[model samples]
Target: MIPPRFAVTEDQIAAVVAEFYTCVRQHPGLGPVFAAHVQDWPAHEAKITRFWKNAILFDRGYDGNPLAVHRAAGDVRIPMFDVWLGLFDSVLRRELPSETAAAWSALVHRIGRGLVFGLGQAEGAPPSLR
Candidate 1:
């Protein structure tokens, strides 16, 4: 395993994941999109937490292709990426320190852009770090 990118902790990552999903489930735009695919909230959150840990901490615990996952979801709209990232960025801001939030938001936005691009979304740009 590689060293973490910054000073964030597992607890922090888990909290953010949980908080983000809580908000996602309530979001008018993103809620239905997620509810259609996510049947087990706990398991999904655990998986996503591991995915983030692998990305942010270099733990190498996650074993899935996010782009493929999103592609397979089919109903995921191009505009959803911006909404998702905006929601995630908001969670980061509320859940983490300024420096750590900015760093993670940068990574999240990069990944969001990749998924949007991989999905053949030709219009609308990913939002910048806020």
Candidate 2:
């Protein structure tokens, strides 16, 4: 596995996930959308923490498909991703060191874009073509 891009611990990642979801739950635009899908906040936070760990630390602890999940939600609009990223950026900047925040922000934005593209083309073509 690749080394981490910056010096960040699992605890830091989990802390960010927890705080970010707290913001998401309180956000007017994001709250309703997420509330529909998330019933157990702590469990969701734990899952997302694993997702970030697997992404940044290559921990291989996360096993969920974000594209399919968002697509299945049917209400996950592309525009909403922009808002989500913005909120996430805010959280990162507030919670991490500048360099770490920038690195993580870049990663998440890339992930967000991929999810948007995947969601957009999901109905247009088969997985083989996409």
TM-score, every prediction: 0.90, 0.93
lDDT of 1 by residue, 1-130 (tens): 5778888999999999999999999999899999999999999999999999999998877999887788888899888998999999999999999999999999999998788777884335564444
Point out where model 1 deviates above 4 Å. Answer: 121-130
Candidate 2 vs. true structure, TM-score = 0.93
Question: Each model's number of backbone clashes?
Answer: 0, 0
What value does the lDDT take at residue 6 in candidate 1? Answer: 85
Q: Which tens-of-lDDT digit does each residue in 1-130 have in candidate 2?
A: 5998678899999989998999999999999999999999988999999999999998998999988889999888999999999999999999999999999999999999899888878475865453
Q: Which residues of candidate 2, in runs, are more than 4 Å off?
A: 124-130
Return the number of clashes found in candidate 2: 0
Local distance difference test values of all predictions, in order: 0.91, 0.91
Reference-based TM-score, model 1: 0.90
